[model samples]
Target chain A: MATAVVARPVSRTQTRSREEEVLVWPDLVFIEFIAAMLFTITLFLLSFLVNAPLLDQANADVTPNPSKAPWYLLNLQELLLHMNAAMAGVIIPTIWLVIMGAFPYFDREQHGQGVWFGTEKAVRLTIVSAVVGFVGTWFLILWDSGKIAFFLHGWFGLSGGDSLRFLENVRSVQTQLPWPEWSRNITYSPVNIVIIGEDFQHLDFPAWLVEQGIPTMAMVGMSAMLIFSLWRVGWVVTRRDALIVLFSAFVAAYGVLTLTGTAFRGQGQELVFPWELKVSEGIPGQE
Target chain B: MTQMQPSAGAAARRIEHARQAEARKLSRRSFLRVSVFAGLTLSVGAMAAGFLGFFNLRKPTGFGGVITVVPARVPKAGEEPSRISEGKFWLSNLAGAQGDVAGVGGTGGILALYWKCPHLGCTVPWNPAFNGAAVNFPGIVGWFRCPCHGSTYSRAGIRVYGPAPRPMDTMAVSVNSDKSLNVNTGVITSGGPDNPLRAKPYSG
Candidate 1:
């Protein structure tokens, strides 16, 4: 602290001119200081009331069942279910980050600098998009659970008709079931979205297309479809308005995936009620 | 040095010339600084190169190379898989006659599955009780289940369930005269369309 000195004669502190310029120290930094103090006090009080969501001391041998990423990364962990590890854990996230990083360059709107929503329509669209995102993602999770179909038949004694066959029959699900739970039916019928009535019933699609490509495509396709549908309904007029829906949906989806990964996931990463979560993969010989 | 007072412009020109001369000549302090920087860079570069040169170093042959697993440690047909922690593999003796799995031969001999799951490298543990309703395959209990993403595989190391792209990778095996199993950890093969043959015919 004692090292603070006027090293230069023309330092920021020795400003001679007083143009209508906002100074950083008292104006911005003071606000930040007050905000930081408020945050620290709030956290202190919260810590007294609530326990930190950290695990017990880690062990080398016993791996926790459904070993989860931190809440922030759990969304990407959720992505692991439907794609190759390289694709899910790396490529897609990298692409997303690049897209998000480039967003400022693409989105150069002059207005609505300080406002939450650009327009009243944007506000309504944001809420609607959020709801759509939450429900749609929830529906997708349920669809992929391999449980919805199992439950409909197992619990309700329903045949394929009475079951949630619709989820299973989603052309992508029917075609590109990537996971082991998706059954070992993929190998027998390699890949290539499959156009019949020709000698070559299949086209070589670089294995990943079957594993990650379809699901990733579906995710992008669904978002595109949502945007297109919303646009057709006249709710979205400008590019920013459309972007509002997309961003809102993305944020809501991020929240939903995090919640799902944290709470609903169980042993073997299966979807289970929070109550049913048995922590470890279960020590090998103990069982 | 001139005794008479020089003009201002002439003095300034001389000073400029002197400054240029001063800039060109390397001082002892600057020389020391440069030598120190060079030494630091060379040593650091050498250390970094040494670190990377580890890959160029010949891989030692024994545990990581051709591992001659103990003969008695191998599992019998239709029994629990034997885990060779040192070799990073599991030896499963599948009984093909039970019709539990497809692609296995009639005898369903020993299959050495690399313990690392294809999903994300979490070591898959064999769950004997992971059977009946738990797995898609009915009546078949023994399975290699990856805890990471729940990528499960058959006793024959076939990708049965989970997010694994392919079946558990298998290492090349050759039997010795004394019946000691020699698993070449180096000679790896994917248990997919590339190499249809998964297991070597071993009673163990």
Candidate 2:
């Protein structure tokens, strides 16, 4: 027995492998339960702070000043103010969300992984385009609103002093314009049949036209840029096709927004020209 | 049996197998033993609190009562009634006559309906321009429209159009002898299409 004594040596790799611990299924469930409970309690507390029905009664005839929806819906309402409610409030949003949900299926790749851009370069580019489109839209709106204020207050006699004060007061509620007898007389005349509504039919346009030409051109330019960007992000098949579809879509959308601003906002007509300009920038017109 | 020689790998495998066997033999009796102890402790705590009537204040109990408002009559055929407010509620008395029985209350042919929609519980507004700006209904006939999902209801609390599943909720009303209105703030019964007081379908 004392003749032969042999011992096998331990390997460092084996020891290390044994030490590694992988999380099991139960651990994940516990974590998920904790997260859900925290989230629910947080929402319950926030509801109290915000005045909860959390509820309120809705009255349509007496529209609230700044007749805006809840904050999340404000974006949609804002769009409705510029574009047709059907388009801005319903169609575009539905299409946008559908397209977003479909993104993972169409671009199946594993390159970028956990990063914000995901794995596909094309997918990242598309994301950037969406961000740019959203931010561009908001930027254009602010620009248009500023330009509108300038043109209406400075160029057109319809918007200075008391008119602006009146406009501000009526911005949230539906307010009728204090149309002069002369304006009313011209409303029935056929000179501006293109502007059918009683409010826009009598707008004093020449006073604000020359300066407005710039914003008008800017609108066309911005619209062109949107087309180009959308095309670059794969909306169009070819350059020529991109040019045709984008220009057509922009014109049609702009026309719709302009019409909305013209009719719905008749009570606040002095702001019509600028309103159209803002409509060109994508703000929805509302009463 | 030949030499009784042992390998390190064999020894390690034997130890792991024994550990697994020990784990598999765990019994439901052991689990019950622990859970029963925990449950008993919780029950004891609850019983102690029960003995205390608990220092917690009892929730106040009361019967429903009326919230009153001045009388509002249907407006003259042409003029729209001014919007009236009673405490926390907003009243659009399109029927122009301002009578005494307006608040939570007694009736003078006054048709009062809560503005809140029964579907998803949103406040519905009367869009005079809903049937389009050209529609002649004006203020008298209009549906309560929910801005949230386009739920529409008639002034008589009936679901005329849109996604509303039932008629709007109605507050109890009582008109007193002094022409004052007493609206009992309780008794909100909202369900299905049938309403007790409505005479006919609201044309709006």
Candidate 3:
């Protein structure tokens, strides 16, 4: 016996009608217009309230006590105080930009499109990452600024003559490792090393590495841990979820750094209360 | 039956041969397309370079640009260095004896030094403490001290001590007809064995 197959025609209009979209003219255009107006008003208000600083005519002879970069670049300048200039100014930012560019390629899912914190799990992850970034960056700024370290030292009664001498000795000398000469030599190599002191006379490369690496590792490691934990716990089942956590963390870190640089840094680029800051001088009426 | 089988096998071979020929044609077309794209990219890059040159697009003013430090904010002789923000340098009016000591030649002797420290490029500030009796360089009236590093420079911008490889860099200084100071920051003389005072100082 032979069997015949039957073919039915499908309607093109029905399939075409499934696509739902709002008109760009009124829907998107009106929203854009409102956003532009809001932005302009905010800018006008800011300009009215604050005047641009104009310092005394360019004197080639004296530099201000703590010369700072423009506000937008202050984040990198803040980073410069803690880490190697090359890493702070170039490497880290370049890596972040590359990662941001590659994000779309890594997350190809369309389910989360046009949605803020697309899933419940993504919202939780973002909040956690943001908290981690904020606390981590703040801790680093305080520790590196010597506020916390000196406070702890003084609290522990280590500021006295003998205790201070012991602390100085501990800082000056490198701890001897039981490892072989080759291993020790490899460890001692100045790859991500810096020598900082009154004259950079000390050869404390390991300490410098550890000091600079803490904040960097904390930021990166916390984000990685969040992704890993989310994956293991089945919270982040997709690449988009992982990227959401990472990007949220990055935004938080950027905001924290900018805030710290703008408000916390004072004369000599030292950490100070916002009210105590004396760096902003030469504004028309501020003087 | 054998003849029919032979004909079927020949047809199969013909189909295979045709498929291979088609693949070769497709590959050749793709290669041509790639070469055209590469050529187009190179031409566009060349055009961009030519356009930039034609438009005289140049880098923004930096250390090497000649800048006018106006109003002649010259420090009194034996006074502290005057900070010139536009030029990003310090202009010091050295005493005649100090200018002679540094071999800097001028009737109204002045020296313009880049604010950057030679060791790590940190801004060096003049510390009045170095002139006090308690300091090691008590005889020196004032000295440049690097806050980042303990490098010190004498009144003449010579490296007195510390990790700084050499003395501070000096720029060419000349007085304009209007009595303004014209500093050729572009022509930087490195501090080494070269005489620091060789640049003609601005006299107004």
Q: Number of clashes in every candidate structure?
A: 4, 37, 14
What TM-score does chain B alone reach in each candidate, compared with the true chain B?
0.72, 0.47, 0.66
Please, what are the lDDT tens digits per residue for candidate 1 over residues A77-155?
A: 8867756777878898788788778766677777775577876588888998999889988877765655555666568
lDDT values, one for every candidate: 0.69, 0.43, 0.63
Q: TM-score for the first chain of model 3?
A: 0.61
Model 1 chain A lowest lDDT segment of ten: A195-204
The TM-scores, chain A only, for the candidates as listed are 0.63, 0.33, 0.61
User: lDDT tens string, model 3, A229-260?
Assistant: 87898888778888887887778888988898
- Tens-place lDDT per residue, model 2, A152-175, is 544664443533432322110111
Question: At residue A141, what lDDT does model 3 achieve?
Answer: 70
Predicted model with the maximum TM-score: 1
lDDT of 1 by residue, B1-204 (tens): 364446766899999999999999999999999999999999999999999998795775754688887778887777888877667788776665532344334456666777777667787777677652231344677677666676667776766545776778888887677767988887777666322255567753
TM-score of each prediction: 0.65, 0.33, 0.44
- Give candidate 3 regions above 4 Å deviation: A1-56, A155-219, A230-234, A280-287, B1-115, B118-122, B126-204
Candidate 1's docking class is acceptable
- Predicted candidate 3 versus true structure: per-residue lDDT over B1-204, tens digit per residue: 988998999999999999998877758778999999999999999999988887884554745677776654777666777777566677877666553323335333677888777666877776644432112222556677654433556656765433455578888888677867778777777764233454345445
Q: Tell me candidate 2's fraction of native contacts, as a decimal between 0 and 1.
A: 0.00
Better of 1 and 3 by DockQ: 1
Q: Tell me the lDDT of model 1 at B131.
A: 55
Q: State candidate 1's DockQ.
A: 0.25
